[model samples]
Target: MISQYLGIIHPLFPVPSSSVKTGFTTSISAGDKLPQIQILPLLDEVLGVHRVNNRTTHQLTVPPSADDDHAQAWEAFFPEGCINPGNKVAPMGGFGFFMKGPNDFATELGKATSTHVLFNYEVLFESEWEWRKGGKLPGIFGGAGDAAYTCTGGRQSDGKCFNLRLMWRENGKGELYAYLPLTSSNTEHLLSVPPRSIQHPDYGFSVGRGAFTFVPGRWTTIAERIKLNTIGYEDGEIEVFIDGKSVILATGLILRDSTAIESRVRGLHFQTFFGGHAPEWASPKTQRAWFTNVSGAILTDERGIHRDEL
Candidate 1:
């Protein structure tokens, strides 16, 4: 079966080139500061890091050597690359850190108190990077306490947790992989873009399949905005912009049913791996990807205007 949606390309929104910089607004004055976790200047350590598939080594790392190709490319774009190893990671990665409450640098930068949040970052798969089946990419996740963990890895979300991550398929086909609170009443409206918006019985929604392609060896900017719905209403929304073009726009989502603190956007979930947890998901050989300009902000409204500006 075809897994992705190859919808008609509306003339107004053209597919973007991975190599070109589109000057998209990635940071906001009112948005909370998401510390570059790769190099934590204030905090002593990240929330946690783990490897998957019985791997012994930590899958996430900063290129320890400056001469490394990943390191060189990272330095070209951001100043931190010189001192901090760009967010480099090996295959089958798992890590989670918060942007609110006591555990995050955000506490020092002021906690993120809004229901809507936006995250921005750039990613590069090395020129020789290998695509083994498919894998996960970093995105926003949140829930009431431990509820967020239930939204991923084949876990069922009981309207308490949610996760939104990007996935890359064979040859770099990309899509928004999300675990949402899908109910019988709102399922039809949530899946507005047929074919493109796929429902995975074991997982969650595979949206915008083939909406954009990740060009190996080039940098791509991803901006995602997530808005929580009114308690008990399907007014939530999610928007993904690849290289500055809107690719996935999902509205009328029901992320939560209550107004609890843990029900709001928590923070970044840095997860990447190959799989179905079988042999095929493992990388054929060692591969690397670099990340930088990791940032986030609270939005004032659904229009995506920076809250601080108001």
Candidate 2:
């Protein structure tokens, strides 16, 4: 299990479909299986593929291209604007996903020491990754929704949650953010200044064992890994992969401290360019690229790599 998680959870080819519904009335439940990226079809499948389901009076929504992950996800989450006058399909956008069960959910369960939080997600985007707050669970976008659900939810003492989002922007930059619950307060990012202001400081996404890079317009994959065990301070590491090439590495995020933000794993979130509202999360606007085979694995232990490989 650790081998696959530490390494990568690559999808063989096509992903299975998840049967999901709309509205906040129904619950995902422990036994209820789900489709990836919301919607009804394509549930439980790997993300990035596009699908269309125009079952309304107004057909403003257009089915996403079979390969346009970014467009597909973005549209699924915010399908309201993806349509036209009557009930038509809108243009392609991005892709988003929601996982109900733990594909190894217990690995990070419990305290894992001083309030730990982690995040992981993957999606395909189009030319642009937009950042806005129009569509989300009430107050999450700043303009409305519960900020706690979108921001503090990760560090909440509750059970667990996961969110994944894909954005379609006009510029070359698009944004995406995933949340992993940790024990603590969201003061730093929730109460910091610009350039230095960071929201959800207590949360972070993995970059394939804390290293990776994702670019725009290209069909790439993002690998995220998070490990935390500390006292006054928690470690936040991220890695990115652009076109299968390593690109970014950020460490020492300082998300947990006995003096401040410290909590336990509650849930995870995925967003598109959260802007300044999202603390601790520096959503790179330029990461508006496409990715496929969105899968994951968890690694527990390992030995030193062969020095010659270096």
Best by lDDT: 1
Give a tens-digit lDDT track for model 2, residues 1-310.
0121123122211111111111110112211333222222222332222222223111113223443333332232322233211222342222322232242342333324313222233344444544333112100111011322343333432213323222222233322343433433323322221112234344433212212223333444443333332445444433333333333333444333443233333333332222223322233332332222333322232222112221
lDDT of 1 by residue, 149-239 (tens): 5677777777888898888888898888888776864466546643477777887778878888898778777877787887877778777
The lDDT per prediction is 0.56, 0.29
Candidate 1 yields a Cα-based lDDT of: 0.56
RMSD of each: 10.1, 12.2
Q: Model 2: how far is 186 from its true place, Å? A: 13
Highest TM-score, which number?
A: 1
Can you tell me which runs of candidate 1 are displaced by over 4 Å?
A: 1-113, 259-262, 302-310
Cα displacement (Å) at residue 304, model 1: 7.9
TM per model? 0.68, 0.40
The ten-residue window of minimal lDDT in model 1 covers: 77-86
Q: Point out where model 2 deviates above 4 Å.
A: 1-122, 126-170, 174-218, 233-235, 259-267, 272-292, 301-310
